[model samples]
Target: MPAHRPRGAQRLHGTLPAARVAARATSPQAGGSGSATAGSGCVHSRRSIQVVAFRGERVAGRISSGDIEALRERADLASVIGDYTGLKRAGTRYKGLCPLHEERTPSFTVDPARGLWHCFGCGEGGDAYKFLEKVEALTFPEAVERLARLTGYELTYEDMSPGQRKALGRRTRLTDLVGEAARFFHQHLFTDDGSAARTYLKQRGLDREAAEHFQLGWAPDRWDGLVRHLTNAGFGQAELVDAGVATRGQRGLLDRFRGRLIFPIFDASGRDVLGFGGRVLPDRPPTTAPRDGEPPKYINSPESEIYVKSKVLYGLNWARAEAQRRDTVLVVEGYMDVIALHRADVRNAVATCGTALTAEHFRQLEKFARRVVLALDADDAGFAAADRARALAEEAGVREVAVLPLPPGEDPADLAASGAERVEEALADVRTAIEFQITHLLRTANTSTPEGQVEAYRRTFPLLARIGDRVLRYRYIRDIVAPVVKLSADRIEAELDAADQEPSSSTAVEVAAAPRPSEPRDPQLRLERQVLQLALQRPDLLPPSWSKVGEHDFTSPASRQLFVALAAAPSGGLDDVLEALPDEDTRRRVRALALADLPTSDSAHAAQVIDALRRAAIDREMAEVRARMDTQREQLSTDERRSLAARIEELRRRRDAIRDGHEGG
Candidate 1:
């Protein structure tokens, strides 16, 4: 996960406070809360402070308490969260795979009535604003402001000059600038200056509709074309440079992309424009071409406040909904492949931005779908890339990873250009990551000679041994490996056993290191967890005497903190407890406890659990007393020693009494 930082930290270079205020005033809210209604007033449920300034002097009035409450009421949380992960109705709540972590079962839940969401697996729970803050890495104010815009609830800055408002809002000015730049390039695409780019697109089989749908653009050959246009639009040179659309040149500011076709990269929501990717034109005149050494085929925006190249995937904004629907994402290698696939109605496809597939990219993909299929060209490079991607998928804990086999030298774009059915047919017959690896090995190996067959077996045996499922391993050895190596299944099994016995082989190491499910090591910790779970799920069943159990009674710090908050929480006020927690980790613990399913418990069972906690606490206290007595034995006076002995006796009696009560119950 990206480290959390304030949105203001991403301000444009040389931007003044006044400019920031203005940008905030004009910037659209980060996201919407719900349907928009025109009204004025503060709702005041959970107020998050927003600090704005007037004439460089700090002030506090931009986001009123009422506006936040109103936005909360208007925000459709499930809809907003659904944009990140798929959710399904589960009784009164909604459940889905947790977006924060990888898991098979649906442990993430949203309760619209309480305006809260929690993950039982990861223990992350919060309201809509908290949800946005964690998922998007936005600050609280940014989250609230985003939802405010989405719900059309206008946020007002009080007692500020218009300039001040503009300055505060300038925090979002860079995002707006990038968006404006996209429009500038897009508007130029249809002009005569873009004729070369248009011809290029046509040759690639992309018509005007495709261009318009993708908001494709063309950069003119002029050095300062974009610079002049943006400067004329009231933006500063530093702002333009900071936005990653222009660079400092010897003479003056120069357009970063010139004489190339442009593709705008948007955020996952397809709302905010992050940056751009430009491809060099094929027929550009030498005089208008790049003055720098040899022109690279492609150029992308430099890393900026809004865009992290490794973290962003091209075409994800358009592909998210379809990817979620299909439970798969087709990852290709270029912008044209994504566009081409979408044009062919294969909408669940995205591409990396002029880089190799990254762990961050895979992490983002996991949130949308369970499976990822690499749709690269079926050349040697594609096969090798797939091999690397499969390792990353394993590390990211993606449920299923596959490779789409295209014609030996063709990619998805080529297939799509030929016909939609060609691309669709290839997708239908994808290979699992393991199968692709075995096939690639076989294709590269000389299997006709006895020596070649032995070499193949040596290479393939380790791969087969790594399979955790015994049945699957045997099936692969029987169906795929045995025929290729001309080895019997029994012989293969014997070889695997011999390899397992070898201490130095990589196969032996991997097999020995296979992960095993861990059991809770501490019984007392388990008892504490049970007590807390009962408190969260069946509070009414808790005996009145259990109220006497304080936070100190629980040994684990997390459990202690949660117990304190739970005790102080009002009836049906789980959100209040969550808000009172000190940090995200503790809050996650509380949410997980609340969402966990506990066995059926009667009042007696609840009492027994609470009694067990009391006994444990007593034992802990007794141990402490005994340790102190031993450490200070010579230093203690007779009276002090007698007092310590009495204390220990009392604790023992209390423990025995609790045990007796449990037995009676």
Candidate 2:
């Protein structure tokens, strides 16, 4: 999650306030995911030594600023990192494909500084403290705490001793402090002062169970109340400021949110409180006047280390598993609506965080379910969002998009407040994408005028054409033309013909006549990939048995690099090499390739992949030879044909130079 910051304590979608002014790891201009500076090897932590410091990396008593760095240097970074990735070697270092997701090649890089190793793949660097925070998925403080326990040490204010490793910086402690502050807010919500927010929830139809399930909270009107409470809890203002919970003002540091209805935001795991969303108690329409240029309602936690607006969908962490189980995702427009739906037993409902859907969002949703039900407000903006979402999802290959229309002037919250049945009724009668678009077009058309009728056709055809699936296109076309264009069946048929006709006949001919050329490759590639995967699974396989002569002929740039990496990896296993892969996706791709090496159900699939690659190489070469022979026959006379035959025999002899005893194809 990219940390988002607000201009005047106001919030933006999918962003949390930024912290850690460390050297900007990568310039935004790099134009890709993963940021690593030149000359910086993959940073890492020594996992072999278990010490539970504050968050759980080193012993609290023994940890110093330098100690973390030392631990990283001393720890076998390659060994510890291999657990998450498949590794190989570059010239001087071990490399691996990243494990975060999938990739066909390695980007994870590692350095064997005494106690730590670093992963360039995910832009994570540091010692055991850092590794735990990055890979083991521990907060810095949690990693410190874990390490402290492991080393049987206690935390103190003593200055870090000289020569201690450079664990991650103190910023990690703030994540823990934010968790504490979230607990503080939840506690305050149950107090008498929280009566209004609690009442608001209850009146909106959220029962006690739903309230507690969402961990609803309240913030007092006073700016400094939260600050005071956190102070008494032993957290410093610096930590709170970093968490975006408090800030340093002209007079003094004070709470970031006050006098609002607080909703704690959780990570995708449904475990960590990454940020908060607060709906101003006296919520007003966006058009309302504000005393200090504030938005009329709905303020979110500022950009912090934990939130990125483009990524976070409010209520999704809790709804994903449910959505997966139901095989459908219900989307509403506001936070309270999600609460209402969940309370009403529709656990699969989620909402955007005060932002419209984007392509990034649709792709994320596709991971869990294909069915998307958009429950936008009945207003023009809501309808526009629905249209945009339908087009976006269709472009991304989603199978179904259903648009549910809310009652006029009623948002999801209002509909739910009126009655859950009305909400359910609307959702239950969800309109398929085409029908929904056509109905909207009809409603908007001015049928009284001839111009209006023509305008209707203009609006309708474009919508129909956007539906990519050919099967669905005609289904929608039938629905639209049935009432409007049906009077002239031949004309409608002619229109369909116009649409079906190629825009450029020459282009169409070129597409149709295109030959499917086989990829030029060698069987050695698959064998090398398999060998590297096995070596990654168990490094002991890397002694003297591996040979590079057979696999170097691979043509895919990425796979070839991986092969070369494994063949040269100095001391680490394939895990080290994979940990070196720069992104989670690349690592996962390598894993997908390596799944062939695993003793799992996909073993047959793996075999198929290897066989396919090797076979393609042979088939391609054979096809080339046949093509040459045909050309040879076309241009040669009788005497030339005999000479060509002699040349063919020589080519055959060269082809027969295979090491195996079997005859060449």
Candidate 3:
């Protein structure tokens, strides 16, 4: 028999055997007639039970319920939520545009008092943990762990052996190792052996302060320097290899990065170190040759358990808050560009990690800002790359994409080194993605000849056809394409129509048209919403006469259900009311009402709402009575006819009395 488990033992994802065994160990039946036999290596005692938990076929650990609750109580919902969106105070809550969806109005709201949030536009609503899970695309346990770390709350695990616990924590251990490796390299950057790398950085216009702020480091020009240093610091060779810092050579483990200046890449939170990017110094003495011959100018960490090249953006850790503040993100070509831009006070800049921009990268960028400006070089190759990126951004559903026009030979880093104002000026002169494409085609084409104009038109037709809005597409054709191509607007339109009708045109980029704003709702429904909003924001102002109103008085089923839930909710328990709501649609409606602006004179407004509801109810009854009289007049008896007529008259009188400010029964 096993010993009794302690209180607050949590149950995470697990198999049935683990669950049953854990229950038996904790239940009062232990050591009695109903006691269950323990499995292999299981130890049961009167006060403690030691067992392993399995999620599917893999070993898993659990977080205590008490710790999760403690984390929730300590975590500030507004602070965590405000990271992805700009929030302004609205009465007792905070309001912002929905980061999860495209909307012109502010429909996303946070109720700090209850630790809840909901977006009326997209219908995304949740507590802090759910919000993190949705925004970060993390699993439930990962969300909990992330929030716990942010709040500085330590968590305890249960129902796992030592081996299981270590296996579950492998990612954290590898991340810590990478962090230590970053520190080691950073310290080496200032040593006597690192003078060449230091000189190289200075020549690139980066001072010691900028280097330190970006945590720039130097990889010593040796095979086993980092390998031996990390091994001596209590990390195993396998761990170092797993962290992408060391590789297995014929002589044994060798440092992956050598004779280069290192740039540490961090997660978006700027806390966990994910990987490193290294730039080779031109003036350094030649080291041993590699088996693959001459090395490239730049080398980045290989993908491992913690890092994926396509999903990460360099400098995002430092640029997240600034991007949210400015509502734009400037993407450049290299780490130096990102560092240089930030040094020049263009703080919301990030770059890809030795790769081209990807759809995943654009999706991540959309979380922080609606607009993305590409600041790559203005050369031919850079223009081609920018076009590809614009297509990807559109496919990712990004709201706005533009490109900054730099000088013919200058990139962002070059401009920054020249002067801060130069970079700022270039940023302000950015053009829309379509405009840039059009301008590039015209400038590069030899428009003096008929062949050149036809070639330019052939290239520009696809770009125009990709525009989702018909009016916008036609405007571009009339204003730019017609003049440049030296063709009539009708000819271009016919060409576009012919291209669109072809089956082969499916390969062209498809842009989703923007959604039209919703029209105003019916006035009677608006009255019902106002009543519910009052109940949510200032229930104290609800008149005693409101008690006479039943669910049938409300025309909308959602409104009726919400009213019932609000009535049943305990005093001062808004959270309970939200929890009791039937579905997400109702909940979204409720949140919108709760966060909407209320009238200044709530007391008098409350009375007006009550009177309107009563008169509306009377009106509905009279309509039904008149409807019945007309429909059933031929078959109805004389008494039924008289009764229906009298009912309609009574309803009319009641409605008039209520409108006249006299209470009518």
Candidate 4:
């Protein structure tokens, strides 16, 4: 009835007193097998409750409270997080910059007393297990085991016997198998049969050290080579298949990679070898025309339990620490590019594993560096990819995105092969996201005629509009676009706004659902916008004194909602706080703040601005109350009229108090 539960299945529940749990478990119908008896060997089979019993009460299926509580009690959340992020003591709490997203100041906090951590910037919050789950992308069981090992707390599961427990740790077993397979391939690469692969690497500028460093391998053309090695080493066929190293062919289970050069892909930590990227060998004296039905130049391990192509970066295991040290990361498109860049001494380099760049990739990179340089080919498709990636990075709150300028038909590998200085020069010529996008548009468009200029405008303006900062958007229109297109800033601004209003293909549904952007031309609304801008752009600079700038100070409904959100998160990222707001207008308003240049106001200047805004807001409220009193005076009863007068007097007094306070300060 309960889905034919497994013999060792466990139903996790809250803590219970030993006596009470045992009493309930020994009750009638708490069925068990073998020599298990009531009281001494009680087992609550239906509810899956387990109880400690006497030695004489033998049972077929075993259940116990085990060492779960011990595991939880021994885990130190602060120490666990401190390993990943540098933390400083903040009273009972520890604080550090959030690793989930880019931020200038620390907003991630850990409360050792409560065994919990939360990121004010990214809204990621959880206990130690959750922290590991997010940081390492580990599953719940994997996290538990990892922490258990760290704390030296051995966990015992009630639902699993010793044999099953050993077998149930499937991921660990698969990971070990993959690691061994990588070693086997590496060993194979150096044998007599691997001469051609060695030649290929040498020709590509990858020396012996480079190949060994990357753990380059050769998968023999014969299918049985890897199969025989792993089998003799005691790995089963199913385990090999699960690891994505072997496939079931018509003849039998065979190695997935055959007669190809192999590059092992690891997780960010460098311990787990998730999968492999294999490149096909080049033909001798290549034909003039390409052969039909030939496999693509490269093939990657299929999506498996251990490997998700989008989640694995080729060189991240090595690049993470280097990126952090350098404060920048280079994201390339291929494994060779990553290796070549590293050989050139550009150590902070990683590449996607045969997939398009994803937001997850950016998130992972953001943990190591604020800046990401996209090292892509000098072609239309490559530029388009770079533009898309830059847009994604901006949306993800990455501080800066740059594109490396390479020569025609060359990638980072080619450039590095020429000379390390050439690679350095190319890196030096990296262009900012918008600049690169503009260059891309100009390159693709025919700029010889007036219509071509219009085409460029059409292609580039939407990207410019994507910028959150209104001031910076206007600056771009005035400074960059005007001279080239010979169009007035006013005309360009009008068109940019018009183009921005067009619904994006990806976010059409969200655009329709979200409120239209507010017009902030009114002086009061402009101040309100500035307040929100400061909250987003310089969260660290926002002082506790500005708590006086409440929702009432914002005249616009959208502004009022945003103010409330910001007030709740005085030192939180706009993106994190925005997620809590129910109103679509407020969400849209906050996103707009992200693109805009931050207002250049220090804490003192901001305090004065807040004081002035509060005074104006009070005056506005009092004026409304006074008008209401004047309009309703005749129709109101005597008591009602008295109430109105009292309200108006109170409003005036509050307004006077604000003015007095400002003047005194």
Candidate 5:
């Protein structure tokens, strides 16, 4: 028999269509209320499919308010996350498909041991219960009951729960510990002897304060020197390993940033300590026997729980606020350049990791300021990178991309050593991306004659296509090219117009060539990571889940869906819990607890959810009605039940008025 639904209930309950329901919702029985599980005594009697939970047993718990809370606690988030993602082994954590949305490169992460997750890709973070509630649309009690059922636990509630408070405290301590570790490593860079790190920087022109400000330090060329120091500081090697600062693979234990000048990498938010980048001092490569043991010219902080290079900037955390303050960001090629600018009081400066400039890097700089000045070394690699960066920034819709070209053989370090005036000049006379590319290519291809002029235009104008500014592009062609190519300003203008009008024979070739500057595989990952980042940053800007949207709905399909889910479910930062998705290789089908993005904690908010739920249900029903009317309207009276059909039509009328009357979107 169907559960008896009171006609005068506080909220209406009915299954409208498959679209509005969870993937696991069961079909309604004939002559039934279409509800599988009745709301428990403590729960509101508005549930549809009776959500059942199991712990590899025959119904260990039911989706009641009491059991739900327990499951919220004990839900093995790894299992729940495994369903959508195909995770791979990434040290201690299992990484896979970013459930927040579609990702080719997994920025979505999960720490099963801690039952915590965070998507560096999108800024979503939280514990297991919160993740499910947000991602899967489970109410707090519903999530709790589901988890309890999944884990066979009894969620007996209390008036004053300490879980949230305790968890907050733990996070503070962990963050502090990471900070202390960064400080310790930074301090070692100063005191370590025979290290010409200071001499080298002085030779190159960076002062002590600048070095220290950037946490520039030399790792004591010894294998376990850091390990011993960290141990004395009461931090376990395991923790070090987990943080991705050191490793203990087969060589027992070793420092990851040994004998190198360390540059710390922090997220754009400027809060979480992500990781580090290390550059070897000159003459200290493996060939030089400084203490007889040192590695290569460069080393990076291994990807740790807090660090994903794809989502971090070497100096943006320190730069973003200043950039936000000053309305500009100084982008340099190396860590020394970033430090030099900072030491010169130009706080809005950042550098790339060992990786080349990427779209992900641009995305971080995007939020801080409008103008982006690229400080490149006046060398081949630097010039090449400048060209690439210009093209990339233009493609990404950055308006003011400037090139800060240092004097030949002199870097920011040398410039800083020269004096503050030199740094000021470099900062002041920044070249726009178009002007820089045009001038750089003219110099590269030898613009001495008509052929040279044609070659220069061929090499440079393609980059101009990316420049969103037409007037500026024409001006660049007129002012810069007229002089370099000995062409008149009018001639240059006509050439630019003709160039814009016709399709270049090399369009496809250049498009293909531009993508593979260093790694062809990077953009897809960068794009996915950016989408995840936006979704995580503003989940509320989106709706609840992807199931509600069409497959091709979002501008960036994966990111939009994740954003919607995050927005739909703001579960105490459940976006973080999504990081715990299990690896596909592990055969982890799913954790029943993590069905939703984040669960609502307050049952009182259940009333609040009623509006969203009704909207979602209405959408589902409307879609079904449209589909049915399109396919089966001819036989509408033949197969359907009259009462149910009438209810559907009535619901549509009510929802349509609400949607059109400024009540619904």
Candidate 6:
């Protein structure tokens, strides 16, 4: 959960007061479901009901149900979910492998009609906010704030009470501080004190336009320059520290960035600054000597409340649209490589921040493009990095991974320095990830004899085996594998057969729609689930007898809880009932049941199902009585035995009546 900040005392660097800012009502941008309009309101917390008195339109400052609904209306759920996983149309809904869980087949589904999703495989389900909460690990308020930004809606809390505002103010302030710090660093780069940093940029072949475009900055040699500037601007030292701009020192608070070139890090939205990546000057005596606490080459801000290194890509803010447009994203090594690529016209480049290519990073990029081109150096370290990248990409289920072959002794930054056209030309001839792996191995293998050829094949066959597509895998075997090993394509194909290795297609894998591994095996539990599933799927078909069904009649604990929530719903809508559920997991189950395809709504079939559950309930009660009698037979007095016998008989009668298809009630 993100830390909560209160308003008023919470000061962000650039955010203006709600009272001073005008509410500009605009339509939702492209890729959204639609515009947030007035009158549509929704309440998130349990026990909260739809109150029509307040409107979603800009009020004095308090957030309204209408405002939330309007935001919800504008966010397209399928499109948002698609950003996290590959979704293919499945009837009116969309289905994809759940990013929330590991599975061979896709069971995650998104209903564009309702702007909701549910995964039958993992039983995770929710609307946009809930999806964001689970996928991004965001709190409710944070999710709301993100949606508001995505929809380009201006939010105000003037109508909210002071206490409520205070609770929400800290986050606002931290974000503001980062934004202010970015501006300060950028402005400082042009000042007289930034002469050395400016010269460094020039030597790298970067110009003024490049610096401003990438929001490049320079931190002065002194410690308190940024500290004093931010504090004088009404931000406290504590706030600066919290935002990762400053660190606690022996004396007091000290700036985290000093005597370095700064690159502001932003989240994918490109709106708020999350942290900074700083590069030490080349000419300066290393501040990161063995005795010094600094790193020798580069240092990024420590992970804080807002900046999560694994989840962020350095140039994503500027490169996402271009990556999507080109259907490819270029993965680079450093901030300068990304900036240099962008400086040349290769805009679809992003870098990992002082970290290895993580599975999460690949998952994030997989959403943008079907293919990823790793633009790494052509050195031993680069080859190792490429191999690690290939493994992570495979783990994340990325469709294609290609390695950009750079000239020996050159990096992307070095190549980009020449011209954009040269970079583009190099990109034109790229090797598939498998080909790169094979080439890498052959270069190391002593393939001067039959034994050497066999060794090379032994190493390369595993790489080809990992390729998911059968056709593509064989193509690589024929085109690249057979010639290298001095064998016909049939011989290599026979080797694959002898090895019993088969390629796995990501799209072909299927997770059967049956009882989930976690589902209860008790017969009555299935009955309870079936009844709830029907009612959830076709709530309108709920007969008047639904009022007679009680939570105690269900055997499954989760099912009983959902039954009570559904029976208590005022609107009888799935969303309304979902909002009323007691906990998130239970709500997720309800959503899964609601979204599942089940028997059609029919009064007769519903009655039969209801009666079956009633019979099961009576049998359960009778079994309990019989068990009591068997255990306490010797201990019971005459009167007690008689009473137990009578109770058993009563339950038996009820069970028999329900078994006969008569209404026990």
Give me the displacement of residue 306 in model 1, in angstroms. Answer: 1.0
Q: Write one digit per residue (lDDT tens) for candidate 6, span 378-426.
A: 5444555666677678778997889898888677888898887888788
Candidate 4 has its poorest 10 consecutive residues by lDDT at 19-28
lDDT of each: 0.70, 0.55, 0.70, 0.65, 0.53, 0.67
Better of 2 and 4 by TM-score: 4
Tens digit per residue, CA lDDT, model 2, 1-665: 11332222211111121111011010111122122223434343322222232211242222233443433334455666665577787766777776543566667666664444554556655555555445433434345433433333333322333333233234345555666777677778889988777887777766666767787777777768889987887877777887789878889987777777788876543435667877766553222223454543566777765555556677776676567766788887677878877766677888766455666667666766779888744444444555557657865677788878777766666766666687678777788765776777767777767677655654565455444465666666565654663334345434544643432331221111111122112223333454456546654434321332235345455766666556656656657667666678777777776555342223333333333334434433443444334322322345554665676566455434422324333
Candidate 1 lDDT, 503-601, residue by residue in tens: 243233323221222212234455678788888888899986686788889867678888888877776468888887899988886787788766456
Candidate 3 lDDT over residue span 507-589, tens digit each: 21121112212211234455677677787888788887778778888876677988899878877367889888888887786
Regions of model 6 farther than 4 Å from truth: 1-154, 157-167, 286-295, 378-380, 395-397, 501-665
Candidate 3, residue 469: lDDT: 76
lDDT of 5: 0.53
Angstrom error at residue 53, model 4: 32
Off by over 4 Å in 1: 1-171, 291-294, 504-665
Instruction: Name the regions of candidate 3 deviating beyond 4 angstroms.
Output: 1-153, 157-167, 289-294, 486-491, 498-665
599 Cα displacement, candidate 3 (Å): 61
68, model 4: CA deviation in Å? 19
Candidate maximizing TM-score: 1
Residue-pair clashes per candidate: 27, 112, 3, 5, 43, 16
TM-score of candidate 4 on Cα atoms, chains taken together: 0.53
Model 5: number of clashes? 43
Is candidate 1 or 2 superior in lDDT? 1
- What TM-score does each of the candidates earn? 0.57, 0.50, 0.56, 0.53, 0.48, 0.55
